[model samples]
Target: MAPTVLRLLLMLLALLPTIGLGNNAAIADTDSTPAELTIANRSIFTFHATFLGETPAARAQRATAVIEEALRGTDELKVSIDPLQNSYLVLLGNRRAFIVSPQDLEVSGGDTRVAAEQAAAVLRQVVDESGEARNLHFLLKAFGLSALATLIFLVLIKGAHLARRKLRGRLPQLMRERARQIRVGQMPLFDMQFVYRIIDRLLSLFYWVVVLLLGYQWLSFVLSQFPYTRPWGESLNVHLLDLLRYLLDGILQAIPGIAVAILIFFIARGISGFSRRVLERMARPGTLNWLTEETLQPTVRLTSLAIWLFALVMAYPYLPGSGTDAFKGLSVLLGLMISLGASSMVGQAAAGLILTYSRTLKTGEYVRVGDNEGTVTEVGMFNTTIRTGLGEVLTLPNSMITGSVTRNYSRAVQGRGYIVDTVVTIGYDTPWRQVEAMLVAAAQRTEGILDTPKPQVFQTGLSDFYPEYRLVAQAVPSEPRPRAELLSLLHANIQDVFNEYGVQIMSPHYLGDPAQEKWVPQDKWYTAPAKGQSADEP
Candidate 1:
């Protein structure tokens, strides 16, 4: 045997119950700190105190050598103990094996001689077993028993495979017959193949776990049949039981805490449902004007999220493993990750909430922000989607919207319509009254332009050359395509009116006076492309 194995064996024996003689093995040791004397890997007795300054372990080692030599001889082993001053001598046949001091004896009234006799009795029993283990008949019987156990183990392993095959054959059909589609409404969450793979993996894992347990039992049983390996076999059984008990107890102890945490979450869910219904009722038109069907959605989600988060805090102590360092570390890691990454996301969400609650923006309203002008298609928490009449879609971040100048054209209108305005810089020669009247006439002639409020013209700026005239009008038909069409018709009418009135609409950006005038006559108004071909594709 390896020296490491021998040392481990000796250390392991120290942890086991000390062997006295017969019933005395159970006797409580008060004064003795004994060292074990093992034969054939089986512990027979113990020695206490050093003989001639030798330690208890050294004396036990010497005694074990003496006992082993006696067993090697042809004569049967004879054990006896002789009393002496302050100690007793354990004798193997006529040879002195070792001495036992008061340290090896129980504190009871029994003398050292009586203790030595008990020790002799236990040694006799152990020596007889060791001798029998070496006998041919005994060895043959042990080999047969081991062979029988091996055969049973092999048969069982084969049977397990057969059972596994039988299970595999029927399991798929059984699972299919009992399977229910996991879906939300008409949509299947996943395909059947995904479920099958998961089942197959679980089945294979269970099969291997059972096979390993069976192998452990078989090996332990085979080891237990021989005297030399019996301690190993017994240790396996004891440790396995201990491990299982620990796991079972831990699970049992954790159940109540887990149940409490689960119960808290269920209660929170109930509260959430109730709060949602209450919030929905509170979001009616008269209840909270800002919380419309569209705007109320964010509030509902936030309320639910807040409730769940609060519930988590309340139930954290009751959660299994919550007190463990690993769970605390995981929570801190998640918090750090969120704090590091969510700066922009949080700003966007806050802006969205402000936009919704303050009624600053609404879906389907025409708005111009920065250089992008379109109808708001969706006002989401992080981004707003706008679809332009020019066939371009814009996804603007909420934070960007909050930071830039915004012009809402549809908010002040009574119905589904948007404001339309066009700027014209006519020469100083054209009268401001004529310019305003002509612009109003153009707007009145255009289709879809609302007339109830009447269009207005503003001389917004008086530049060095001419005045900048802006014609502002309201147009019905909130749809984006109609707005573009109405603006086109208005521009066409303005050109026709200016031509019919014999007034040349000239840009006032010239550095010098023109020779005559920069005017496109009525004949060329519908230039080759304006009538059919693309005038200028955007």
Candidate 2:
């Protein structure tokens, strides 16, 4: 029983120094059984101990507090150890001491005095290391490294500038030589100077990127030099690497979708092109006999646009952010805006489609729409452009054209030649045969009047004072000549024919006949400046 009591006491002594007095009362509350005691900063171990009872815990707590107080002081720390009653004494300078038992030494497999001395030496070393004076050397080293980094950065910038200058001087000529080798139908595919400029910008961007990375690394290194700021440096590096990794992962994940989208784009493009080609071939004069040439191109274009729109809709879900709420909101907003703003555009497109399919008007045709009479130059989705004989180009909205009267003169000119008619009143005294013969002569003399169909004269109306002599002649079928000019020429021939035949054309309100006969004699037909062929000829 006595031996067992001794062993219990020895074990109790060994365990006491490990637990602090502040924590001894809370040992039953704590789940962790602490076997060692370390200073607050955890830079060094103070001693080996255990959680058991009050007496030794109190002694250890007091000694640790004394050691910490001594470390906080300005005086130098000195340690010594000695045997005391089968245990050991660790002396801090000449004032304070801590006890180490044989059981404590046995826990670490060492003699009691040796263990006490070692613990004292560790405490002293820790106290010295905790002093603030030693950080100056590290601070100075950090400054030196920062200065060296700055110098290297400046040197790199200078080298980059020189390299940029050299590349700018020589790259354009080389690009031009290379571009000259790539030709399409005798025209260079790409502009050499433009390509060189693009490459120069990319190279400059690369250099700036390198410079930025170097600066970031230098900054990180400088920050990591101090213990306090080292965590921030580590965090910066970790964040940058994480961001890069995330971006790379996203790119890799999106590659399949991007490939699918590209494939759809190429397929749609090929289909549109092939369909357009087929439509073009069918539009030829003697091909598949489908649509007319005037309608085929517009139909093909509209069909291609519809196909591409459908393709885009199919490809939408595969786009990187198409499923995102922001993308959805943007699409809705855009669609709303378009719906609100495109009323007139819708009307114009509808009219254009109708006009195209109806074949009421065609390009290169002479047509009169409302007050605007001209040759149709362009028929667009929204508008139609016309070039008049007066050299004015008129752009009219398709909606307006659909609402107005469109007189296509070229439509009549397709088969039979266009007929030009003029009416004149004559007195009853003049014979009808003579009047008809004179009108025929005038029609024959007109430059653009067709000869084969011949001119025909009609006495369509008789009034109280005179008879209406309507003379009609065939002109060129919608030939690109001024109608006003042709009318002027025809009128001039009629006047000369009348004046040569001594027939007075002023019979619309003939109250009485003129006394001396208001007629121009045949001899005076070519009078004065009217020097040309005689008007009396057949």
Candidate 3:
């Protein structure tokens, strides 16, 4: 029993040193267990720490490790380990915290208990210098702000779209009302109102353009915030914005030209209105003989051209290329081309101007030019247009028209008066006196033949089978339908009168008859037909 006890005592004595060493190492490493550390004056304590690299995931893991380390041991005044804190405790003494210098691991103390406890507490509270919590909080706040901004942008865009739709729905009615108001306003200021209308439309168009640009800009900004579209959005926005800006610049540059054009339009409209009124007053019955002359048309045309020319001079510099060297070069080139190719064009134009001032013909006039007989339809600067009796239109160069002989039938009288001449032939057996009487009576019987002019007959020639007699009489010019009727009536009257004297009138063409008797007086042999009996009686 004594030998066994001695062996057991020796074994217990050897295990005691190992257990004490283990306890001391565990206490030194403990950070979770509360410890009281104290420090002396002029002493600094540094807490040694290890951490994962600066990455979000690594930082998160480090935070977790620190928390785990803090909860490691339960000893109230014992030095404890906290892996989450990434630090080791250096308990000096007492309940006081130690002054720990992060730069170096040095410890000093007034008392052992206070220094140990202070060092332990200071180490437990150590934090990284990077301010990870502050950065995370800032990122969360930024995301919330961005989401709010996007929501606001969407609301504004939707509201603008709805407003535009409502405005569009009412646009037609607004236009009509504005137009009526303008029409009823002062006549002299009507042109100004028209210009205002154009400007208003342009402003509305510009507004829509700006709205679209803003919408595109907002969409691009929003897309740039998204991970998928961020890169593409940046590039797309740059190019698209550049193109839109270029378009806007071009439109801005064109404003001067547009203004000049508007001015020209207003001036022309005013002049035309005034001129039309003047012409109407002048053209009233017996007021002015020259109002219908070709001078009036040319004068109006020249006045309008002068106005346009003045406007063009003002507008030329505002055009895209008008002030550039290219414009001068183009002018030179155009001059060369015109000199080479436009001689005929110039001649035609000059002739047209001359024709307009000559007052030889006007529209709706029946004209005979060279071999073509037609009605004038239009007279242009380069050519004259005529509509032929066959319903065909002919365009003749003014130069050609100037050189040709032209007869204007309508210009001879207010209503083109004409003479109707008929020729009748009869055998030599017909008496000349009787034939003259018949022709004269036939002219008097014809409807539309003028009585004041009185009909005349002449013996034209003696043919092989008959003597040719001509009957000429004046007719009313305005009666187009009566011309043919009068001619038929004249021929029928001559036939009836000639047949009463037993003379055959050959109209298809009569050659004098050699076997027929010579001409005689109508009072000697010719007798009237029986009452109610036809001249065809034998």
Candidate 4:
């Protein structure tokens, strides 16, 4: 079994010069990620293809052990490269240790020579460092340097911490004292709370960046002090610079995409402005009845939102990383989340649009939706806010406003006012004309009730005992407080006028009839209140 293994090993070595000879494109297509070869924690180089029957990972493992063994030898090891037609022999002290094939070259030209001078340079560094690691004087010197680096790193980090803490405490006080000077009229140019938050965040970012840079320098210095890990230390610095370069390159590449996005948004903004102007022109008296002053703002907002959304959709493909799977997945995830939350929101928004476009509700108009009655303060996408005369503000969902019966009080008046109404039930024995006259007189006594259109009293219902009278009149001053005050005044006057007429305002309810007649006699037919000819009549 041992003899068979030895023969197989020899055969594998002999076959290395002729194996893995495929074209570069084919080898790269086979596996895009190459396998890395490392010594201890230090990376030496990478391999792209299989040699003989060994995979790149397997080849890396074999090369690592052999290289480490060569470095551990006591005798002086002479390292050299032997080039062949299809491979290169990496010799250590006259012994053919490993082979570098056409597949291993970082060659820009054809796979002609073993143009792995980069690999040779890396090997030479390793050999020199291994020898230095054996020196007691160098080890002591490196240890001292590492200790100094660590101490410096800690001191700098602590100083940054104290500086940040002091800044966090004092910056807000400084800003607060100085902010009063930066004001326009009475309004401050900067809200103190917002400025504090901005300052704190900026300080935190700077502090963390300083800490990270200090930590990186410390770690790199410590690693570089050791011979075995010197390559890793160098790699750390190289990789960080490479990452920063990649980021800058990406930013430069995205410039054209950003410019296109900006251009699209600019055009959309112009179109939105144009549409707003057109709507405003159409809002001129008798130009477009549907596009009135009440609806102009919302129409403009919705139009602008739609135009910007369209522009975003058109410019999506040109945005940086928009084609990446990660970007697509994130977009899909966000869409799913929105869809989950938007079920009721979409309905309410639709109802709000319906209320807006249909001219059902407008801000500052008095309205009664179900039991909620107030002036519409805001007709938002999700809710409608109304402020009542009672000094209470109510937020009703747009869906509820659309579903419930809504009565607009402003419709009955020429100018800004609300229709105020009150209901009363009186015995049938009392003439309805007299009752109406009493109500009209009461309305006349009330302040802010318009008399030109004339107050109206309607007999809404006739029950078993009495008739229901509803007195509806328009109240002016166009405010919530005045409307409430007018209703109270009207009710008070109704009682006083009825008392003057010697008429009972209580609704009569009786199971049995009285022996005497309940009707007013003919002699009293020309009574003072009849045909509203009383002293209060104008």
lDDT of every predicted structure (CA atoms): 0.79, 0.74, 0.59, 0.78
Predictions ranked by TM-score, top down? 4, 1, 2, 3
lDDT of 2 at 37: 40
- Tens-digit lDDT track of model 3 for 67-101: 33433323233333211121222331222122222
Model 3 bad stretches (over 4 Å): 1-157, 175-211, 223-292, 303-320, 324-347, 363-365, 370-405, 408-449, 455-538
lDDT score at residue 260, model 2, on the 0-100 scale: 90
lDDT of 4 by residue, 326-417 (tens): 99999999999999989987999899889988989788788999998888889898899998877789999999999999999887577877
lDDT, candidate 1, 1-538, per-residue tens: 4434533543443334444324332233444466888776766566654444456677788888888888788787788776554566676776777766665654334577777877787788767777877888987898899999889888988888888888889877876664555666766666667777887788888888888998899889988877778778878998899999999998999999889889999999999999999999998879976678877788899999999999999899988789899999999999999999799879999999878887777998989989998889999989999988777899999989999999999988768888999988887888889999999999999888889679999999988877889999988663445456677889989988888676767563647666776666666666865774333443
How do all models score by TM-score?
0.68, 0.65, 0.47, 0.78
TM-score of candidate 4 on Cα atoms, chains taken together: 0.78
Q: Rate residue 299 of model 3 by lDDT.
A: 64
Candidate 1 residue spans exceeding 4 A from truth: 1-194, 225-233, 289-291, 338-349, 371-397, 420-422, 431-457, 471-508, 519-538
Candidates ranked by lDDT, best first?
A: 1, 4, 2, 3
Q: In lDDT terms, how accurate is model 3?
A: 0.59
